[model samples]
Every structure is written in structure tokens, then in C-alpha cells.
Target: MKNKKWFGLLFFAMFALLLAGCNFNSSEKSDDGTKKSGDEKDGEVAQVLNLSAPADVPTLDSTKAHDAIAFNVLNNVNEGLYRQDESNKSVPALAEKHEMNDDKTVHTFTIRDTTWSNGDPVTAADFEYAWKRVMKENGAYNYMIATAGVKNAEAIMNGEMDAEELGIKATGDNTLEVTLESPNPLFKTLLSFATFLPQNQKFVEEMGDQYALEAENILANGPFKLVSWTQEQGWEMEKNEDYWDTDNVKLEKVNVFVVKDPSSGANLYETGKIDRVKLTSALVDQYKDDKEFENVKDSGIVFLRFNHNNPVLKNVNVRKAINMAIDRNGLTDVILKDGSTPLYGVVAESFYFSPDDKDYRELNGDFNKGTPEEAQEYWEKALAELGQKEVEVSINIADSDEMKKVAEYLQAQLEDNLPGFKLEIKAVPFAQRLEIEKAVEYDLSLSTWGPDYSDPMTYLDMWVKGSSANRMDYHNPKLDALVVAARGETDLEKRYEMLLDIEKILLEEDAAVAPLYQRGSAVLLNEKVKGLVIHPSGADMSYKWAYIEE
Candidate 1:
């Protein structure tokens, strides 16, 4: 689960980072696919738009979705209680307005009269049904247990309490009330997230196991609906005319292609086949001078996750040696070529965890960045303890151009820095990589996590013992205690401090996962496309407010 927190990032295998060009300011594409000078709104509203995506969406079911591909599509096709506006503010969406009780433990929402793409009226019961469904025992939704702040949610998911007893009710057709176990400051903002989005009860039941498997099986109430989904190839979305805000939606159709090749995506953009394409590091130098080039800042971390169950990786000295041996500076500055910074800890600098505006990373200080001498010391000690003069480790990564380069870089770094070490690289498709990680079938897996929300806990909580996202099999009861303490603490200052300590234990002591770099993308976009939501957290991108000009 990239998002165990409301602002969670994705973690899987292979080219895990959404490494591409950054956010765009302005530029336009001519008919021949070349760049042209143009204003924000150069012509009349265009009915069709084309874009390139890195991969195909694995699932469309909001409850089961855990990747950027699925979430990006869901962001446009499903309306939540609130939606993140272009400025990243939580603005009213399905719920016209909401009010919190005195203690902030209970909230009442006044939902607007809306209709799904299939013309069924959206109702409060739909949201209630959706929430309960995800809370069912072993429902496998990434964020269900993470949302235990909702009263009885944990108990229901644990099967100790019935889903019907969860603290959510439809006081009226247009009225929805939710009671929380405690006051969560991020609850409203969490509503804007895809995992918390509404689903149609009647429609879901009708489709049963087939729900959201394809275009025809899904129901949408957002600005657009999934009209066609071709697995691996691409998908198409059309504006939902039944949407309450149809008048504001400019593009009638959105054509998205799953272009896994960076060079292919770049060519598509140059030829006017796609309005936006993520740039690979190999092509960043070529496009860096282009006016349309965008170096968008990302709020995520890329790391090397060790499967602790592996006999070799289970050794603390071995894990520490691997973590220190890598040259993160070289990777970020030279290999990535984007603005990504080397991370010494799991938490990114973008997060301000304390009330005094102190960054969590700074608080934890730097961990071991291995010099040749230091790495040798740890490696020798590790081998001596394991009774082996040499070792071989396998790494699993996504089969993208950028990630392939990353795996190669690591292979070179580790083999050169640590003696008696041989490395094997496995490059597989993005979806297959995720399956391998979930099954804990690899020795070393390159992973990335985007903050599910703005809080530092989003980054820190992933490593806690027994967490759904903690596929590493790494556990420290001491670190787990800090996480639990932070969650239950009402005082902001104390909570933030606890989080800082937790990160220290994870990176400095246990080396549960080796820090790689903060995730960011260098992207190219047509200036004619306006109002695309490029957020720092949550879903990587959203097109709900986007429109194209002629």
C-alpha cells in the first residue's frame, strides 16, 4: 500500500518512481506536434485530448485500488465528499457542505443531488454501503484498516464487530453522518482521497466479483466516466453528461495510452499524438532547455527494501552495509537528472512534522552513507558471521528504461563497494513486480512510497510491524511502540517528536529499508491544456478540472 496514511505513496517493484518531467507553466503544441507559443486559452474549447501514461491501471474498484494508475483514473470518475481543487485545497464535491461536532469526533455532510453515469441517483446509502464493504473481513482494500479512526472500523475489519455497526449512518437521503474513534485533523482532507470515494451500492452488487474489472462494469459520478479500458494497451474516458457540473467540463473525450518506453513517449509528444509525456533522465538533457519542460516536485521516497525473511538480508550488518554502500548523490544528480535529492532517511524534506516548522529528515540527521573502507568493514563482518567468504543477492525491479538504469547503477555500486558480492537483476512489468513484492518472493526490491497525505506519519507508519504495506518482514517492537504512541497522542508536538524517533530507529539502527531519493518528475506538457491538478501528495495527477483549447 503506497498509502497507509491518507497521503500514502505507492510501493511495488521495477521502475517504481514516476520519474518524468515536472509541472508545466506554459507552452503549446502545433498540429505537427512541434512546440508553439500560445496563451492559456488560445482557442475555442477542444472536444478531445490525448495523453501518455506510464502503465495500464490494474484495477478500477476504488476499494481495491492501490496504485497511481488506478487512482488517477478514479480521481476523475468518482466523486468523494470533497475534491482537491487545482490549488490542492479540499473543496466541496459530492457533499455540498459539512460540519463537525464540538469535539470533532462526529461529522455531518449534506450531500448534493447527483446521478451516476448510469443515471442512478447517488444517495447517502451508497456511501454507507461502500464503507461497510471495504470493512468486511479480509476485504484487502489498502486503506480500510488504516482508516480505523472511524469508530468500530477496526473491530469490523477484525471480525469482532459487524460492518453494520460501524459508526456511519444515513440520517437522510441527502444527509450522511460519520463518527470517529478520535478527532483526526486530516479526516476532511482524507475524504478527498480516492480510497474514501463513494461507490454505488446497487451497481456494485449487480456486478458482484466483476465490479470495476472493465469499463462496462464500473459506475462513475465524477466529471468523466471510463468508457473503454484495453488492458496493457490503453483506455479512453468521456465526459459524464449526467454530472451535475457538466457545464464546466470542457473536453468531451480523453485518450490515454500506456506507453512504457520513455523514448516512445517522447516521440509521441513531439508528433502531437499525446499532450503530455513524462521525460526519462536519458532525455532530460535534450529537453531541459525546452520552454515546456517542467520539473515538478514530488512528495515521495524511493528506497531499497530488504526482505528480512531472506537469510542473508536478515543480518543487520549486511543490511547496514548495503544501505551505506550506495552513492545516492550520484544517483540523484547524475543518474536521475531530475531535481530529485538524495535521501538520508525515509522521510522527505517536504514534510514539516513539528509545530516549529522543523523538517523530519533534519531532526533524524544523516544515516550511514558508506565509504569504500566503511562498507568493506561491515561486509567482511557480515560474511564472517554468516560463515561465507562470498555472497550473491538478487534484485527485482520494474522493467522501465529509467528503472533498468537504476538497477544497473545499484548493481555497479554494490559490487564495486562490497567485496565478494555478486548481483542479479530481474526486470519485469509493473503489475508483475507488485505481485512479487506482495508475495515477498524477492531478496532485494526497489520500492517507492508517495505520501498518502501531508503528515510525516504517512512516511513513518509504513515500516511498523504487521502493517499491510510493511512487506519487508522487518520488525522492531521498539519502533512499533513509537508509532503506536504517535497515533494515540493528541498533542501535536509530542506526536511529531515520536515520529522523528521512529524514523531514526528504522533508518539509523535497523536499516529496515535503505533510503534512495525523493521522487519527482520532469515532464513536458502542452500549454493549451489548462487546470490539470498536479498535486504534491495523494493521487499523482488529476484531470477533473483540466480542459483543452483548440
Candidate 2:
């Protein structure tokens, strides 16, 4: 996990549609008298869809939400200017009509007539306020605004100008105009992203700090609204009858229960308490032959991030040695039996295709691959360079079952492959792990990144010196320059070539980060759950078009 010419909104939309939609149909059924749908409109088929989540919602605030779980929730509870259809293509939602200039520097949109769950009208001002607020606050993901090529966005982020000068405005009650510093082919794709989703400015101001903290505090303009949410327990959603496209929303309610452990989630599914569950390696083994077993591909990469500030890790050969030592093939084949695969480049496979119509991985073969012999050579050189025979390092990781197992495997691989290497694992809660990484106090950290939109820049730009996601204190001037050029380059081929060069520098030459594997999920979904679109990236899954076929 983890674009085109400056043609305009319609061109962008077409490109998005051509992208491989991640949806895959699967089969399962709960029929032993345990299947229950609380309420139904037809008195036959219940539209309520039950699911299991690896974690609870961290936050529902669209502007601030970062994790997949929270973004998934926000995606359902709110509508932005655009949304992904069942085909996982960008389509207009709140903004019914849109056009961009020939240079793709300016975009104008017509906000559709819609109301929030609280009965307030959804206005063009909502989008403006939300985006400006993001700049003014400069939160963790604020780089995204600048990434969209919004004019003066970086200046505003740097405090050189007010957020009001960030090149977006509500020109009329229903019209929004946005000016971009440069042409962005993926701009329309961002419209469907959670961060770009609009906010009711008046309501947010009224709630203050408590906004989006609970079900009652949040407002919905999409297919569903949060009916109730019990922290660490479960959350429930009901159809938003006030939604602009309510008729197309098939699911009346979606009940998601927090089940952190794969075994626990499987147990709930077996007991008929949940309809969908993800399988761990062991569960995948057991359920491989089951009718409900569906191994879905994911566009996320689990990688090891080296803190460049660390004296030991600062040695490029040491980073390369670490990269070479790990047996990613074995890790994915055995440790992650849910179809995860070894990833050699920063950008995961099946994620981004270039303007020339070649997959990023297909275009750039394995870049940083190394054998055990190579690892030993790099290790010896690193030791001589640092005047050290051995070093002890700790890897910070989230204590999820999958991550813990992977960490253990990595620990064994490093300690065995590189003689005198002492690796320590410090596994903590997911939230705590994030805080630790954000502080840049860890020597090494294992992290996973899902793409926001299908583009090489999504993965390449994170290591651009001062990006918020660059928590490893890693920066390469050459890589930074390439990223900037890639972002602003209007020539698609040149931009794509820059992406290739950036990946070469980051993954091969500098070894800025060690990519481990591309993650895949083995899920058991009830066959009756129709129209569920599991995207490769951006918010994980969508229930807007999902419904219980029972």
C-alpha cells in the first residue's frame, strides 16, 4: 500500500474508472436459525449487514481521521464532492457538476442540494471551511492538502499566508472554486478521499473539542449515520434517509463489532453474531476449503522503517544489510498465509499503473533485492565503517497478532542471518505504537501504509524530508527533488520516470525504508452479503452499496 495528463475532471474520472476495482464477490451464509436481522422493510430480506473490525474507530473526524478503520467509518457516514461507485471509480456525489480549466489549475464545482443528518444544508462553504481548517490546524495529514496542488497550500502550512489564501472559496451558495498551484491528474481521486470530505462548519464550531468524539456529535450526509457507538465494544449505523442518493444505498444498517483478534472475530462469525471475519494464517489454513473463504488482495505494504537519526541505522550499509537479511518470501509464504507477498520496492504491486500503461512493479523490477551473501558483505562493511563489531537495536511494533508474528520472524531472521546482531521487539497497542513513531524516538519500527489514491506519489512523497508521515527522520535530497518534480511535472511520462528514480533512490541506493510484504486478507463473508465493495485502498471497504441478501 500504496496518474495522467493535465486533462481535467472528466479525464480524471475516466482514468479512475479504468483502475482495477478491488471488489471480489465471495460466498457464506448464516442459516442455522441464528441469523437475525433486527428490522426489515420488506419483512423478508433484512438490509442490516453485520461485520467485524480489527479495532474500534479511533476518530470519526473526517479531517483528522488517519487509520483505515476510522476512515472506513467516515466514508460511510459522510459524502464528499465525489465517491467511488461499485466499480470503485470516482463519481460525483455532493458536487453534482464540476469542471476544470485546460491547464487543470482551477476547478469549479456545483454543490448538490443535500442535508446533514442534523437537517442542516450541505453547502459549498462546508468544503472550503474544512480544507482551510486543515491548513490552519496543520494536523498529521495536512500534507495531503498541499499534495493536491492547492495554491498557496504549502505557504499557508508554513505560516507565510492565512489559510483563507489557500486557493479555495465558496463562490456562491452552491458553487466551489479551487485554484491549484500546479496541475494534478489525481485531484479528482482526492475528492472521494476521507480527508477531502466536507464538514458542516457551523456544527463543528458548535461542538468544539467534543466534535466527532461520539455518535451524537457527528453529522452525516451520506448513505448512513452513526446510530450508536460503544467504545471498545461495537458501533451501529442506520441508513441516512436524508442522503442525496438515498435510493441507491442498499444497506439499511451496518453493525460493526470490535474484535481485535482474528480468532475472536472468527468465533463471533461462527456464533452468528457477525457476518464477516478476517482469517489469520491458522484460520486461513482451516478455512481454505470453506465456501466462505475469500482471499482478497490488498494494496498495503508492511515495511520496516529505520530511524535515520540512529547512529547505528544512520550507516547506509547497515540499513542495506538489514534490508538484505530479512527473508520476505518466507515471511509472506509461511508467516502471512493470507496471500501476502514479498514486496521489493516502496510502491506495492497492483497499485499504480503509469501513463504508458505499465504497472509500477512491472516497470521497475525488484530494486533493492539482496541475497544472504550480500547481506553479510554489507553487514561487514557497515561494522568497519562504524568501527563496531555488533549492535543491539529495538524494533517498535503494534501488538496486533499479525504484526507480532512478523516481528518475531524478523527478529529471528536478523539475529540468525547477521552474526552478532541483537534485535529486541517492543510491541505495544496500536495507538501507543503510533505515538512512539510520531515522536521519532524508536530505532526501528514496522509500519503498514495503505494508499489514499492509486499513484506512485502516494508512497514516494512520504519520505520528502518534512512530510508528516516521514516519522523516521529519513530524508534524501535527491529523493526530495525527484518527488517535487514528480508532483509538478505535467508531462506524464517524465513524471512517471521521476517516480521510478525516486523509488530507486529511496529503496535501492539509500535503503531509506525496508519494504517487507504486500498484505492480503483471507476473509469469510456471508454469500448473502451482496454488493460489498472491498477497495484495494482508501477507507478499506464500503457498505454504501452492500446489503444482506437473506
Candidate 3:
């Protein structure tokens, strides 16, 4: 992940410069049967709409996906029973209706008649099988721990029961019932996650353990079907004419190209080759004057991760010192010229379960305001405690130009602020950086997290005990206990209290991670595009409701 503060600074700078002289003009009307600039034609169909992103989709398998790029792709091919809307509220997708028992432990779902691309009738059994596979001990699903409801789910995942006995059950062909050990307040939100999406049991059994191993084996039940994926070239999705709500789908095809370079993406958008492109700091200034450049708020948190297992980073004082040294505001103002906001807490700013609640913003205190004097004091204390004459650390970063700028800036800041401290920076490709992080081979790293669901737990629970994502091995028994308690507490007030306490402890006392900022996505879209919805969770591209102007 690039330094979000810097990314924000760069974006803001570009936005400020662009708005200075640009006219906020209304979209022009189109004629001659072609779509008008920013206006949709009355009866035209977009044969293909091209889109671009910084990162390539890491995996097509929803169970194994842990990154935003993968989620963007898998969301098109698979969908859960429920989905989060623009307001971050849960809404029905595959399920027609649902009810909760008195105790709220049992959930009965009435699924709509939907079929997979392979022509298999989707049923309750499919959900059951998919849930069980994820809760299995060796399941590849990244958020499988959230599957606390399946029969013997916790026990089976913990190696105590047979994996086949997990809690999901198919009462009938179209009816499904799930029994959780306790009431899960975020149950509906969890259903919106990719891990809970139903899969074809027969298909998985026939393919063995490698089901959905490639484009050929996968099945889609969403609005679009995967037409083809040519690796590095691009992936194509055609609107599923067989979709249950096909009448609402307007785009005939969605063509996505894996453009890693932001400059090239901006150029493509300018030339009208692609319908949308993501603008980075490098290209923000050049296109800020264009009406096509639209600023989008993304619920993403960029931060620095310390390898707690590393001998050098294992020192709490050292971590705290580093956190106090960086100028977060400067990074946000200088590096990111977009609408990025500096973040003080683990959760991103304005992120909350309730749309009306402003508690997260109010509770977020300044933890990383760049106090060089305080950082120097802590550095001296850390050096003395370690019995070392000097302190040195290397930060492993991604190979993107934005990341390189961030790493260099941090190196200068840390080295200049604290005497006898040396900062070394290493830039590596994303894949290589992940391998190094997995091996606990780096002292510090740059990373970001986009929510898997619309819950605070989605951001906080990754640090819980036995979590695969807790690569740093940050052991906070009290924090772990609080997270576990919050999971079972259905009362909204109590859960909020628990989360606030956890955040305070993690941000103020432990300094587990240094949060940089919350980012805004700059997506340049053609005037012809209409009904494009941007969800806060950054989950699916809801092109079903989207239509190209005719």
C-alpha cells in the first residue's frame, strides 16, 4: 500500500489546482443516435465498457482472496444472499426474504430462484456445502473465523469435530436455515461477504479440492458471467441475459484491463478507450480540469505494519517512536492532492455500522501527529533499553512510484528527527513483498485494509488469536478477549462500547499499528456511463443497475 497520507496530499493538491480554473459545466447533450457527453442515449447499448485498476486480481477463488483487487473480480462472478448498499446497510440479493427467531440465533432464509452459469439450480444445500468448506480447519477462506454459526463450526475448525457436521443446514430446496452458537448482530452484514456466497456442491465435489481453480471451473450466479480471462492481458464479463433481473441490466459487456501504470490509465481514459480509469498522484494534476475526473470516497485505511516477531521491531518503544516521528499531515497534503483525510485510529474516518453515527470521528484521537521531539525522546529511551549505541531499521515497501515516494520521505523524516538512528528503504514488487511479510522477514511494511463487511469487527478482528492475517503475531490477550466478547454481544450499545475500548487500547497503549489516512478514489468515467454505484465496502461493481446512455 502506498503511504495514504502522501497519496491524499497528492490528490488534494491536484484537486485544488484543477478546481482553481476549471468550469463546473453540466454535461452536453448527444445527437445522431450516439450518447451525449454525460448523457445516456435513449436506446443505445454499450458493447464494452473498459475499466482499470492499480493492482491485478490476485485470485479468482473467493475463499482465498484477501485483497481488494480479488474482491472486485470475484464479486462479479459470485454474490451472497445479502448485500450492502451505498449507505452500508444490508439488502437482499439472492434471498427474497428472511426472518430471525426470538433468540436471534436461528436465521431462516427464503432464497429466490437463481441458477448458476453452469445451469445448476442454486439451493440451500449449496449454501450449506460452501459454508462448511470455509469453516474447515484448512479452508482457504480468509474470513472463515466469522463463520461461527455452522454445526460444530467452532469445534470443527479447531480440530475437535468432523468438518462435515458444521451448522449450516438445507431444510428444503429453496429454504435455508443457519444456527449460530450465539446471536450475531452482524450476521446479515457477514452474509454480504464473499466467504458466505453460495457455491455449487456438485461442482466442487466433482472437481475435488481444486474447484474454481480456473475460469473454466468457476460458476457465477450474479448479474454478469465471466466470459474470458486472458491473464495479464485482461478479463471480460458479459451481462448474464439469463440473470433473474436481466431487464435492469443495460451494459452488454464489461471489459477490464489490468493497467498497472496510472499515467497510461489516464491516457486511455483521455483517448476514450476505457470507460473508467483510476487517477493516481502522478496524473491527477493533468486531468483535474476535465469533467470526467470524479472524486470518490473509499473506505480504505493505509498504515504501517510492524513485524512483531522481528527482534528489532519486537520492542514496543521502537514501534511507538516510529509512529510518533512521521508527519501524517504533510504526507496527506503534499503527497496526496485528492480528498484524503488523515486517520488517527485503526478504523478509517467516517466508517461506522450506523450511517448516522459520528462516534468514530469523535472518538478518534491524534495518535500519529508527527511529534519529532516526542519521537526523539522515545528513540533515546529505546536505544538505552536495548543496550545499543545506534538504532537502524529497514522498511519494505511496494514497487509503485507512490510507495517509493512515501518510503523515501519516511526515511528522511525518521533519520533527521532522531539522532543515531538510520533508516534504510527497500522497494520490491507486490508479490515479493507479500512473501517477505509472510516470512516475517521485514522490520516494517506498508499495507492497507478495505473492509470485508460493513462492521467495525471486520477491521478489528484480524488481530485476534490464531488469525492468519495477524502476521505480526501481535498478542494482546485483553484485546483478544474484548473482540471475542463483542462477537456474541447482540446489543448495539454494548458492542459499540467494546469496540471503542479495543480501539483505545490498540491505538493509545499498545501502538500496534501506525495509521496514516483514509483515501478517496479518483475514478475518471466517461459521460456516457450512468447508474454506476460506488459502495463504501468497495465490494461489488453493481453494474446490474448501471446502464449506458442510449
Model 2 TM-score (2 dp)? 0.92
Q: Ranking under lDDT, best-scoring first?
A: 2, 1, 3
Off by over 4 Å in 3: 1-47, 137-152, 208-210, 353-356, 368-370, 538-540
Q: What lDDT does each candidate get?
A: 0.78, 0.83, 0.71
Q: How big is the positional error of residue 201 in model 2, measured in Å on the Cα after superposition?
A: 1.9
Q: In order, how many clashes per candidate?
A: 26, 4, 28
- lDDT string for model 2 (266-305, tens) is 7657645577888889788788998878887788889999
Q: Native-vs-model 3 lDDT?
A: 0.71
lDDT per residue, candidate 3, 108-186, as tens digits? 9988987899888889888887777666635445345454444466576567887677667899999999888888766
TM-score of each: 0.90, 0.92, 0.88
Q: How high is the lDDT of residue 406 in model 1?
A: 87
Best by lDDT: 2
RMSD of 2: 10.2
